[model samples]
Target: MKNLLLTFCLIISLTATAQRYSDQAYLQDRAEKFDLNEETQNIALLQIASDRNKAIKILSENGLLHPYEKKIRKDFEYRPLTDMHIVALSRYQEQFIYLTDKAVLSNAWAGKFYIDHGIQNPKGMAIGADFLTLVAGNSELRVFQNGQKIWNTSVNNLNPIALEYDKTTGHFLILTEDALYQLDLTLKTMEKVYDGSNLTAMCYYNDEIVLGTKDGIQSLNRKTFALNKSNQKLPWTEITSLKNIRGALWFGSTKGAFKLRSDGKYDYYASKRWLVDDHVVDLEKGPDDTVLVLTKEGMSKINFEPMTLAQKADYFQEIQRSRHIRYGFTTDLTLQTPGDLSTGYNHDTDNDGLWTSMYLAGELFRYAVTKSEDAKLNAYEAFEAMERLTSLPDLKGFPARSFERDGYEIGLHANGFSGEWYKKHVEENGRIWRLSDDEIWRWKSTTSSDESCGHFFVYALFAELAPDKAWRDRAIHQIKIEMDHIMDNNWYLVDWNGEPTAWGKWNPKYVNSFPTNVGDRRLNSTLILSFLQTAYHFTTDEKYKKAAEKLIRKYGYDENANRPATTIGFVEGEDLSDKWNHSDDEMYFLTMPGFVNYSFSEEQKTAHFNTVKSHWEVERSEKNPLWNYLFALSGSKNIDSEESAWWLREFPMDLIDWKVDNSHRKDLTKIEPNFRSQTYSEVLPGDERTLHLHNGAYRNNGGSDGNREYAPYIYLLPYWAGRYVDAISAPVPN
Candidate 1:
């Protein structure tokens, strides 16, 4: 009866606290509620429209506007598009025609469903000069008029595998393995155009037969029957299909895909960012600057137009609301839905506590400045998720890495997991956790120190700025529990297996073991100082201060805390030298803000302030808006407000992880030694770099792994932080 009553009450409590979010609905409502000049809605919208028009006019006053449409990601809609071995694609006026395997599908406006008119064993197809559809088979050629076969015949002993129509002379051309044939439809005569055995694909351009063959790309003259080779060479071995999209040639081959450059060389588009699969079976350009490619996986649309910054930010926001934000914290994802893109796209995270804490920090700042109730709800939602992490262990204050289903995870399914990992699960309370029989969940054991640092980092912000008294009290309560747990356990986060998780150790044996110049020593020392500062600031507890003083006065940790800002760049033989640790840089900066802001006195504040300033002095060249604004907030001298704003403005509006390489470019500026030892072309990080994690700031050339899309938090954190701190005004929505 006791357990049942407790369970009954717990259900009611959890039910009462759970709040579902409707982001778009809530934001739309909030925008209405916060809409400026609500009494004159038309007048306000008119003014905004005029302002937008003026901005556009000024942008285009001296230059002609090249109209384009940018593609918003619709990850799910393409699912129904299906993986087809697309052999040919062409646009006949308004109709979209494509063939895969032996089937042909015709649609209008690239619609999801085909028009249901199809052909069997379609080896190749094209629209003839007479506007009739011509399809070539293994040994036959057929002409169709308005979905009905008007003509079908066996070509006289010529194995026609591909077809092309010539508008210049009203003729049809055929491609076989070793020869090209030109058929005069008016005269009913066939002429051998080019003699080549390894011919792959052919198209007529400017009255010349442009051919993609095994050796190279060459043109055949009809009258002379002479082959003139271009300087271009095939990047791939076997060119499967050739397409004349808007007069430019696009080629698909076994190795990758290509578009012929004006200089006659081929530009390869093999990277996943460009193609869903590198072994592209087919490609076509559709309306609105859309490049559609087909592979073994499915068809994908590529947007040639780039977005404005505002659009990129909007894209980021939509992705966060729709895809990346899970349980109110930002994390990576493996799969997502398409169509309206209104799915959760939820996935588990190993660093749930850590990642959530950073996102929580962003929302806290956002709500502090904008006073948006939605932002507050978002923050608290994450806060609730985080609170569950700490309390699940029932080990006073030990935080878990994550929680998962009881047996769904096959191995080590202990602690909400099963399978091999179950062996390491330290049974506390009960093995089945009578919370439920089958629904029994487990919190992950052996959480990392970075996760611990992250929790303290956000709790400091929340303790002071939670929108409601309940949230504020919860923040303070969680802070004390976590701090006490660490202090009681002699400053280590004890894991489920009864040992400190690999990175959570901060004892003297761990701290003093590293030489003074070591990065970890400074990093760990800064982390502890910040953690202690945060705990004391929230609880006004003296023990936290005393613990901090002993580390500083006894072990020279304060000196170590000041080491990173001075020691990070261009130096050799210093402990943990040369390799840029962006993650550590992230932690160092993440912690310092709290440590300096909540320092017990002015003297301590000044010293910490200087450390941040020195650090900023070195980091200024990176042109990251987040770091600049953070430095400005930290009281750094000579911090350029315009530079910070420039960083935000220059942030590439496209957040998709397209593998970008500027190393081969003839236009790049000279590379110089920045602090990171990474060669930077004169361009700023925000302007030219790929969409990367915060740690990827210094790397100029690299491909993104996975689907490589990003949550807008990186942009949002800095954009809003600048707005909050008055570093940069938000650009008006266009």
Candidate 2:
């Protein structure tokens, strides 16, 4: 009885002290978008080049020119250079030399027509201090100065494929089908420098002239004329173009473009992530230290803008507000045409509640840290969207997975019913949609326990941090009914069909049925306990507290919940244990706040904290900011702060669902496939590989055609949570 009274007093203490979050700022290095934005430029940009200072000049196929400086796109011009068909371009001093299909044209310093060379049948041209070297008619090499052909010559029966003016030697290097020739500045003296066949592109790198061939690249020393093959393995062997930008060797290949890094490995820019298509046409250094990859389809400007963590949060907030929110729910945008943002439209997804809850929770954390009015309104708007989910469904205390207008739910199940799995589970099992009592709306049913985890996460945060007392009380009330529903249904989330949803089982009978190796067994136990604890903490409801105590004391839930993540691996015959479920990791991390913060006793808190730390150890390699910040709630010093910051800094600003394929990369060290599905020894940074939401990051490569855009809540939640928990600070005064 004495122990029982002590347990009751401990529960009371949890209600009093568990809700407060400390407001302390730990300053850390901050790292941090666009409008006319990435989407617009993704469609329009064609050839891209930059000056020595990295100021960008973009040219569309139709001759529109866009000059970019700093972060702003300056004034543009339509067909600014000439009326003739422009084939190529080169920057000389402050002027641009446009090589038209028939002749040559020069643009004035500020984009007006300055002079026309009238050099007929010009194939390409290279500019020098006072003369323009024009390669014409496949064999003729001519030098034009002040709009007059000063000298002209022809190579002996050698078909020129490419031409480059060597700045160091002040001589012209002509690449032919089988040989390279050096022509003097006077356009008279010519010498056969190297005899190599199948050469495709040429560039001057320092003291050597690098030649790209069908096999690989070889550098020819200008002084000795000795050609040496590049020993480093390349991403793609068939090199198409080569450029030496700021002393770095950048090359284009049939597959993609890459830069030879100082470490000998290549920084590959492939797929839609870095280019419009993998078949690259050119490579240039872009404005603000960006990389411009011109592909067969269009051009991609990879920007490396520096920003603070707080600034990054604001940028995503703007993106979410502008594109991702649909009927108050943060959502994915379905693009009708691949890589076209104009064709994007929001549609209902399977995890609507889960996604919105994450986004809402993020806004609340933002409010808690900065107290911005916009954050409050954003949180409130999403809170209303979630409230509607509970009310739309007819079942008492049961929230719908999502809701839509009555007629808009047409072909809802039919749209997804192509396979036997959908037919058997969705069509044969039970009704998945039901019309609301108001007759104006329809709500989806069969909400999973993971959805409940998300719902409870935001609700508890709202109850704890929302400024208005009424709002906090409303959140507390929602938690009470949700908990009561689960408990009333025998520790299961009973659906509209008067049965438990396939994944909503939290009772000990169902959870313990799985072997110890399965993740669901441990995750479900923690989730239900967290739900019960949160309900009791906010509402001071004795029933919720008692139910939690019963689950722990009678069902060995404490032991089940404390199991380390390392034990979870493939169990030979178990279907659920075939691989590590990233979604389960998502559920566990989402449930962490309530699980650790609302512990009924000091001992349980310590045990749960240790469990969290153990789980974090398993996930530390991924360097997930969300998981790191969630673990920071336990007040542990080993939160992997630098890893978390690196993740935040490296995350790509372009959240477009581009088709990213890194399978052909030579740099990645492939590993034996494991239960975790980690394809490499080291995971790539966010911008280098496919960008998935909470359920991704371990895989080396996979993506869709650029047809969707993910809501930024993944970055937002972790960043704001980091700020709220004092793991990060506000912007460092610019």
Candidate 3:
């Protein structure tokens, strides 16, 4: 009867809300990496046409509609070495017709072309329904139908600079250096639409003729041809090209390409995330409603395919296993070259245990929600790796940060810390490595409080949720051993040198040393109390309970834990305590689940629940799915479910750390940088910004050139946790 009651309570706690939207097709946009092998200055124009048969075949063979479909369907066709100096290009019946300095020609068709006619020194060209038009030598307008000259007219003094076919008016629009003209093919006459200079590009949009100029966009009424100057600001003033794609006006400027949204905002695409170069030369529509932006070096095809959040989860799961796993722990991949996955090599990190715990906890929740055998297997594998961390150092219960094979540099610098600052810190704490009993490996030491927080959080879940009694017993044993070591060492993680490692101190004197506003004061107090509560809840150890009560009553740890996050502000002259520590946000939230679940009394649960709520209220603006979902799991009904779903859907399919820069964007409203380090007034969407696991999500910009790929645990943890809590739904068949 007692076991039945416990199981019932577990189910109620794990599933805390009603089910949300099921999986259905939604547009998920991702950038496909494509670049040319060598540089060329003679390239004239880029043209793309739909290749449905090729796209379908590639999709059918790989069962993945991505990577190959875009490559095969919308691949750019460019001249390798054109000494003819191609001046203009257009698509006619799925074939490219290009005009050069000497003559006009077809890529696949070899009929005697423009030069054979009277056309010479063509300035620009456009393809019509049954004919092709060009401003020949900027002196005359000529048309060709069925590979034969059809019509000719004079526009010599106009000095035509560009040409386009307006299907609505059945006329070829021509742009001169200082004027716009419409050439009626049927009437065989030319009429000037509007006189304008500095007009670089033009496109038909929303029943109006839109023009790109040196300053910004200008539009003209098609009927009256009255020009209206645009008040809209762009990412760059020098508009190079324009295209109307699916009702949205896309502007390609010297900086990047941006789509004008209906909300008067711009969806800016810049950096290596979207283009090979910021100088967008042309914009065109591609297969499957994709948008192609052409640069001097290469083209960027933004593919928007139908996908559910669940499908995205599966994709990331495969990525995690294939690229990130090292010795059963979710590890880092160091690349020899930027943006090149082929050069990536798996490496051990200092927080292997912490990172793996988060991933294992995610898998645990996944198994709870779906009963997936794969999730169970993944969780157990990560648990074994963490289990090794504790025992590898040969200390009673001290956990190593990470481990690598012998003969690798085992210094503080090799472990990612460097210079005199880290050198002094490591010297004060002793060496950072200890050899295993077998003497074949070296384990990194000086495990910090966040590592302990992660272990306590995940091990507590394992003790309660593991399928077999043996696994549950093992988890409980780990909790007991670690808690005993802390208590025995006078509330500090005593390292191999018999001293507390830096950042692992939790004694009253150490934690209370900082002022209350200093984040460390509140953070360390919450961590130790949570550890004790978790240990006591699982083991029913009176000593663990006594240690927690003593801290609460004598050291005021309960009060410290209850302090609102708003109280955590800068501490002058205290480098560690000053400003906001984004990493502590991870530690606090990760520890809160264990802390709230294993509270000794109802009063403690209520107090800690408010702490989680207070922290979440501050973080609500970021729309972070993980933080919001975890807070909802703690029994808050005001969770931002819609925002969470938006974040998950907007997260880019490509996880490569491409260099991203949003500082040049005019769409964003910058704020004076504050304590939280929020640079922008509004947070960018998940796909628009760079995301690192421990960094602030509100950061508008900053990334390296595809050198690193973060573990997918950042998404998996929040997604599975939300699912387990019934805040998110499983996919339903379309």
> What C-alpha lDDT do the candidate models reach, one value each?
0.60, 0.74, 0.75
Q: Total backbone clashes of model 3? A: 2
lDDT of 2: 0.74
Expressed as tens digits, the lDDT of each residue in 1-734 for candidate 3 is: 01322632454455444446465789888766455432222343343333333221111111111124223232233333133455555566655565665556654445444444455666667777755555456677777775677788876575665687877767888876678888887787888879877888888888788888888778898767898657446767788888888788999998888888889788778778778788887777767788877776556788888888888899999989999898899986778887777898887777899999999989988987888999999999999999998888877888889888876733543365778877886677655777788999888887888899999988987876678789978988888888888889999998888888778899999888888888888888988988998777777778888989999999999998899999988778888765678888888888877667667887888899888789889888888888876676566666777788888887777777777777776667889978888888887887778867844666667878788888888888888887876667778788
Clashes of each: 20, 3, 2
lDDT of 1 at 351: 73
Candidate 3 weakest ten by summed lDDT: 56-65
Q: Cα lDDT for residue 48, model 3?
A: 34
**Over the full model, what C-alpha lDDT does candidate 1 score relative to the true structure?**
0.60
Candidates 2 and 3 compared: the better one by TM-score is 3
- Candidate 2 lDDT for residue 481: 83
Task: Tell me the tens digit of each residue's lDDT in model 2 across 305-380.
Answer: 5567777778888989998887899998878897667898887766788999999988988887789999999999
Clashes of 2: 3
lDDT of 3 at 622: 83
Candidate with maximal lDDT: 3
